[model samples]
Target: MAYEIMFASFTFFSIMRYLITRFTIPDAVQHKWRWYNVWISWIHALCAGLGCIYCVSIEPTLLNNLQDYDIRFAYNLIEMSTGYFWYDAIDVGVLSGSSLKESLILLCHHFVVILCFTVVVVTGDHVPIAIVCLLVEINSIFLHARQIFRMAKIYDGPFYTVNKIFNIITFFMFRFVSLSWMLRRVILDRSELSIGYFILLVTSFPLMIVINFGLFLQVLAKDVPAFTVLQKLQGSKNQNRKEKDACETLNGHMNGTHQTKPVMKAEVVSKLE
Candidate 1:
């Protein structure tokens, strides 16, 4: 069933990519191939994100017993994602025009994911842990959206801004926070896990941390400039507000002095009379 679902998932994404490229994306769009590639990825992220959430929601206790808990849907989701990664690895690394140097990191990432997922799918152990890792796809949903929007030439707007914020937030939550929790679980449950699984977890954890941190820094580097521009705009507004208040204060003082002089002259005239 898992292998069947895995092959089906791969075929489904391939068909979707074809249909999207054939009918959905306009001919006028530049880099149509890249768009379709990212489009499929976005679709996968949406599916995988929701699927992971549902699987976990139905069996919240899985987190407590990562080694013991097993659910059919969880296995299916892992296989499904594994299929997508396989497709992506081929499409991006082999078919795309990108140089090997440029595609090296991404290919390596896909390789690691497929390898780990294959181990879990074959052994039927650590399905819960795999599901937890799939939770990172929740962040990928936003991460891919950022790419789609950029491809669509939507660098800034309300929609883009909101997506950007969510992208950064989920990157932290799912990637950093969730991965951290999983690391803790692995450490605490080390005795229960098999030697192979334990070794895999220990080896993968540092790589996951380094890769995610690097990606997080890149995300910050890309998104932080917008924040800096916002800060500059805000500072200018604040400065203008202060200047307006200062002018108002000067006008008020000038008006008070003029009125006081008039009142003093009136008093003097009354005293003279």
Candidate 2:
């Protein structure tokens, strides 16, 4: 029941956002601010909330929920990207006054940390999976902070700085807390940390990554023919409906059940002719 409710809410939110953007909402936000801080803050809440819920819920580790919120979907019930995820691309470019070398180092560290984490999963080593995830998350938060700092001057007042700082601190704290919970779970019972849990973690994370990356490339290549495909599909449906209606009419008439036209007197028919 909880799963169904969450899935429905997630889908509703996604559709509402899309409709607003496509039809009702203006191209610009009312505050004339980019959603950089808002986006990061959302991630923080998602991680913390899911982490909490996992501990509270009677299902698998809140990691499922964590992925949903982190992946920007309340649920990954669908295999497609569904526009419920982050809109901005994974930006690598840092702002002015930021050292290019440091950015590269952070980016490389991000990849390396995640790679090690991946290796652990592939080798079925859940022990260090939590640790590696923590490291990678920290690197990711640093990269975001770096960009935010560089872009501070471009922002109005000190709003960006303050909000970004909050975002960073909250992000770090949540991830750390979440990691602690996993560690405790592992320590409490080896059986509690079985391959079943590991498999879910391993399978879901990679699937999300692959699906997201593919969507990114599809968007970049400008080959997402969703609307065109939809139009073609609708046309086919309409054609099929028309044919079905014709068939029904033909069957009714050929079965000698009714006249094709209204009956009239012979004099009236002769005059019309």
Candidate 3:
């Protein structure tokens, strides 16, 4: 049922994007096939965000037991989001015209996520998985918004800055807090999970954390700082231009006074003679 819903949603969104973008969205057309990949990401992020919210609202204590939980529609929805990633990994990896390194990193991330989610779903130990999804997917909405704004050439605007701020805050809140919670569970909570399952969980979860942390640093140290410097440079240019204009105006006034005084002095001398 989860697979069916996800596959159907994926197919529906793909065709809908084709029709809508072909006829309606000039921006999508302008981006060529890359826009379709972005649409896939956008839809997945929306589903994941909503699914996480619904899961937490209904079962606030779901994360209390990492290894035991009942499987619900919320889990299915979260599982369905993995299908989008799978589809996108193949789609963008094959057709998105991105660089090989870029494609490989994206595919690697998607593959790891799909594997982790599959293990949790199949083993019916879904509580920690739900927590992971809640942490990871909620912030994706803002991340995709930043991408969309960049594609639309509005990335330097106020709205994009707001979205970036939200992205940073949510990333820190969800990723750091959730990882810390999961680490505590691993150390303190004993579960009947298979050795293989435990190993996979332990390895994959932290690997993702490391990758995400590196990306966060890139955003903090590289992207955000570049924008700040650019704004400062622009401000400096404007200030210099204002100072130049003021000096030019003062010089003009001084020249006018000098010229008029000379003319007045000539006239007074002629009258005296």
RMSD of each: 15.2, 21.0, 15.9
Model with the higher lDDT, candidate 1 or 3: 1
Lowest summed lDDT window (length 10), candidate 2: 79-88
Supply candidate 2's per-residue lDDT for 227: 49
What's model 3's overall lDDT? 0.70
lDDT accuracy of residue 229 in candidate 2? 77
Pick the winner on lDDT between candidates 1 and 2.
Answer: 1
Clashing pairs in 2: none
Which portions of model 3 miss their true places by more than 4 Å?
23-31, 221-223, 226-273
Error of 3 at 155 (Å): 2.8
Clashes of each: 0, 0, 0
Residue-wise lDDT of candidate 2 within 1-273, one digit each (tens)? Answer: 323533453464445434533533233433212334333423433453453344334334334322112321222221111112221112233321335674554354334434433333333344233332443234244334434444443333475456445544544454444445444444454454455654555454454344434533433233225645776799999999999978876887889865545434645798989
Q: Give the per-residue lDDT digits (tens) of candidate 1, residues 34-148.
A: 8889889999999999998998789888888777665677888898999999999999987899999989988988888898899888888888888889999999999999988
Collision count of model 2: 0
Q: Which predicted model would earn the best lDDT?
A: 1
Candidate 3 lDDT over 19-127, as tens digits, reads 7466444453467576666766777777777777777777777777666556477667656765666677768787777787877777787887778777765655755
Report lDDT (Cα) of residue 166, candidate 1: 98
Once fitted onto the true fold, the runs of candidate 2 whose alpha carbons sit more than 4 angstroms away are: 19-156, 199-273
